[model samples]
Target chain A: MSQVLVVTSGKGGVGKTTTTAALGAAIAVTGQTVVVVDFDVGLRNLDLVMGAERRVVYDLINVVQGIAKLPQALIRDKRIDTLSLLPASQTRDKDALTDDGVARVIKELRAKFDWVICDSPAGIERGATLAMRYADAAIIVTNPEVSSVRDSDRIVGLLDSKTKKAELGERIEKHILITRFDAARAARGEMLNIKDVLDILSLPLLGIIPESEEVLRASNLGTPVTLNDPTSAPARAYCDAACRLLGQDLPMVIPNDRKSIFEKLLGRRAA
Target chain B: MSVLGLFRLRGTAPVARERLHILLSHERSNRGRPDLLAILRDEILAVVAKHVSVDHDQVHVTMDRGQIVSRLEINVELQHPANGPIAAEREKAAMTIVHQASR
Candidate 1:
């Protein structure tokens, strides 16, 4: 069965779009059919990151409002045959994405792809909520910083209270992906280490994308880091994250709080 | 990197962690907390009242984040009526268990 996942961070520029493209490409390289849908309306850039910008004849808004067919709107990757993208409309506002429209598109995507990843716009607004509304799992993109971690905590709150799974009384699987992690800075106590971020977010550690210029170069070249330089640290991290998403067993940066005995012993607490 | 910083006590990360701990705990406690806490206390008191009489003011429901976990600690102070049989014994027994353990 296919899984719908959302890459979200309560704060912008923490790499939701980058993660969406890299993870999707990495999964597709493993021969799994993956489609990354950009939900950041009026700022659609997943196609750019995936190098499918010029091929976009239609967009998510077009498919949702019946302006175009789903096939007509989805842009297939030039490099990876199994990878595709459902680009958001740069001309439309956040209000263009309706709940029912998103649900229909997600259901259709689910039937066709092995993985459907949505790149949520920042903050807990209509755009962000709609992006995560239909997700079976969430990749909480975060950076090792105070503001970013705090925003992620707020997103966790919304994920627990506002999503479809929460409304149905089912828990949506959540994973924390800490990106741009600088080990040297952390050692110097300038940046928050992986442990500090995980302790506060208290979610399963997906993978840590270390600070690297390769990511920036890949985006500038209109390619995902995993495809541009597969052996690089950031690329390897993204690939590991994709594998973990596919149920591969791997060691993490540290002990994640989801498995912490402290939580197990404490049981459920007052919300 | 000062002398105090060498001891790992002055990093901004620690400060941020401390601030987040306080903020999240406060925010968590307020997640439907005011009425929810009252309802939980009343419901728990009602259950205990079925087996043993408990005063409405005797039940306390709290949500806290210790170093270990986010906890919903419930403390029901079971006190015997002053005139009841073995009331003195029950009073002595009550002090044995703090709010840390629950049956």
Candidate 2:
């Protein structure tokens, strides 16, 4: 069965859609058949972020509502052959998504793909809950702030109680992905540190995406940061996260100029 | 020396005290036990009323950060019916009553 991963955060503008596109692209680069689905409904940003907005003729609602078949709704990426996108409907109402219809679509996608990633909408509403209903694992995207962390705590509670795996007494693996991290601000005590966030949330750290202009640029260009600028800080961090998701033993690194210098020195020493 | 005087003299670490206060407040407003004080007050009133005439409105019960348990304070005006007139006893009871209720 395909691993269903939901990229979700309780608070908005915490980089869920961005992370979904970047991670989906990164995973697809490994030649795995991956389809990133947008469950954000009316506010469909994933298709635009993935640079496939024009290609979206039939969307998730179309497939779920039986207006379009799954193959007809799946938008193949021009850049990556292994990657495809199931875009959200811009015209459909959020209430149009029925649980049974969603379940059938997810079941169908799972059988056909290696990785089925769903980009969840923000907040602990029906849209978010449905996106996570059938998830085997979750990427709990959070920002280093009090409100975001509190909202994420509520999301964690829902994940424990509302998921199918949880209902069946099976544990759903959850990882904390802290995005928009500013190291300098954190050092100045402006934002919560990594240790403090981990202490509060008590979930294993996935990877941190630093606040970078590259992310905004990638979004504007309708491409994932990992694909737009593979060597950039945010892209590298996302790629590392994708690798970790694939069960690789990747060393966690703090993205900073000092760390980069240290890496270079260590490389020279080894050479 | 008074117990409170000793606490003041010791000058308990402010950071620890602040953390304790914050944690206590958080626990009080915690999702699991937001109405803990009210529950405790009701239970205490029920228990105390069985033994003596407790002025339920005048009863004071509170939970503070420094204390491990809830504290209950009650001020009662004892009425010796055999030694005094009913009117005098009632007047004394009314005068002895404190206005401040539970925290």
Instruction: State the lDDT of candidate 2 residue by residue for B15-77, as single tens digits.
Output: 333443455445434444345555655665676567656545545444443334443343434
Q: What level of docking quality does candidate 1 show?
A: acceptable
Q: Which candidate is the best by lDDT?
A: 1
Q: Write the per-residue lDDT of candidate 2 for residues A1-271, one digit (tens) a residue.
A: 5899999988999999999999999999999999999999999999999998888899999999899999999999999999999999898778988889889999999998999999999987878988999999999999887667777777887788888899999998999999989887777555777877777778999999888888999999999989997877888899999999999988887563234567776774211
What are the per-residue Cα lDDT tens digits for candidate 1 across B1-103? Answer: 6787668754577777788887776566556446444455566556767877765575556665443344455666667776675455443212111222111
Clashing pairs in 1: none
The TM-scores of all predictions, comma-separated, are 0.75, 0.73
Give the residue spans of candidate 1 off by over 4 A: A253-271, B1-10, B32-103
Scored by DockQ, the top model is 1
Error at B21, model 1, angstroms: 0.9
Instruction: Provide the lowest-lDDT 10-residue window in model 2 chain A.
Output: A254-263
* Candidate 2 to truth, TM: 0.73
> How well does candidate 1 score on lDDT at residue A147?
87
